[model samples]
Target: MQPLPRHWATVRETVAFPNTQEYALTIHGASDLSLEDAQRDAQERMALLIASGGPGQLHDSGLEYYPLRRLPEELLEELRSPGGELIAAISRNRYGSAVLNTDALLISDVDLVEPSPQDRAKPAGGLLSRLFGGGRQAELTPEQQDPDAFGLPGLHRRGEHHERTLHLIEDFRARHPELGVRSYRTRNGFRLLVTGTGAGPSSKRARELMGQLRSDELYMILCRVHDSYRARLTPKPWRIEVDRFEDLGTRTSADETHHAWVARYRAASEDVAVCRLLDVSGPAPSAVEQQIIDLHDRAVRPESGLRLA
Candidate 1:
């Protein structure tokens, strides 16, 4: 039988000056570029804006950048009236980015594979497949290696690898009966409903049990998050902050232990906004049945959060 087709997942966010006007450039580079490199990219972009606009002055805070502005009349007149045309001639002969930037593409991506049922279960194709592919596959081209080689990450969203993650999670749930998970469909991607069961003398223990379950679930998910993006040459996604949360549990005023968890986890993942509960008996629930319920009185969104440690 022919082997399954390879799957790649790519996501790119247009980098901006945040509070300033947008520029003609974005920052994309090596998968492992460091702090100094990022700042250099910013400086290079500032220079580019000058070229596009011509003879300007610009500045930035260590944290943010300002769009280039034309130098004042006195300075502009001095440079132009005397040697400007000579410099312009030299610049015309130059043959690269009008800007000083070497990193023309600011996008980053994680290479992925679409594994079949057989592949998903194979120890080689499981989590490790996220990193190395089905052990000794054909080498990827240089374009396939560095997303920059292609100029852009992709024209549209690539979510088949996402389906693969869902499959991995299902396999995780099957192998580990101690935990429970459900997928929450969001506008762009999936959030997870995570819960687990454990017995304890006090609600404290129950909360701990729930925490452990969330931790384990996140470990598996994030393992994929980091490991799945296997390309070593191109940049990986800039930020990995929490996108959303599936209602994991709800809490009454009296459910202090659970409520405390809600506050702590929610604060930790302030980006998310939703909550739910699994009868306070999750992962390893005791006698209570695992009937999922809203943590609030009205039909509220699941603001509860996950700790992807």
Candidate 2:
């Protein structure tokens, strides 16, 4: 899983070029770093940036070239198991809603809208691009090209996408009787939480299962990159008619403004639910899984009867 650094800090530096022009650069670090340590790290990185002719010269560089092992969100809380293992974490995403992050207990969502052929063929480009060169186009394997060939039912009719997606979920439940699946209805599609199968987000089994269930391709890529699964626990700001919170960058703590914003968001979101509980199938969740489910249910208010956001 991506390391959720307990500490964060930011450093700023001014670099002077040979042409007598100066540029200011800010860097954020999450390595439990002291101000001095962060400053030193920033200085080293800035020196390299200067050697490469500053930030202006690196317009073509892709994000894959950068080392990004830590999640770039503010950690709100951490959940642990009886044995002291970190089971889950709650973090404030950039859009101001809380997100649930877990290294275990697979969580995936299936969008209602199908991707176009071109979109489906696009490479995810993290470890996949590193293993197979970025220029290579992704080709659908036989199973992806023909899901029906693997005993999975295909959606044949128009406007039945929702029902067809549910059918796929039921098919998955029928095939994998050993795993427990909890389904919820989100505003855009369905959210699935699986248990009784101990597969980490980046595991091969997880990849295959998510693919078979038709989880969002970008979501799968993000899970693989971050080594974790994520689910939003709160309504989107716009959905609740609240403005987005300011981008806090790498600040270690929240201020009065952030607190006030959160207060308003919470108040507006009080009558809204993120998702509604649809059904549970397969088997009962284990003790640890139940703990996660409880936490998730509390945050989402699955039975609130309010409109999903």
**Model 2: ten consecutive residues of lowest lDDT:** 142-151
**Candidates in order: C-alpha RMSD to true structure:** 25.2, 11.4
Model 1 off-target regions past 4 Å?
Answer: 1-157, 199-292, 296-309
* Model 2 residue-pair collision total: 0
- What is the model-wide C-alpha lDDT for candidate 1? 0.29
Off by over 4 Å in 2: 1-3, 9-28, 32-63, 66-71, 113-159, 247-252
Give the per-residue Cα lDDT of candidate 2 at 228: 83
Question: Which lDDT values do the candidates have, in the order given?
Answer: 0.29, 0.72
Best by lDDT: 2
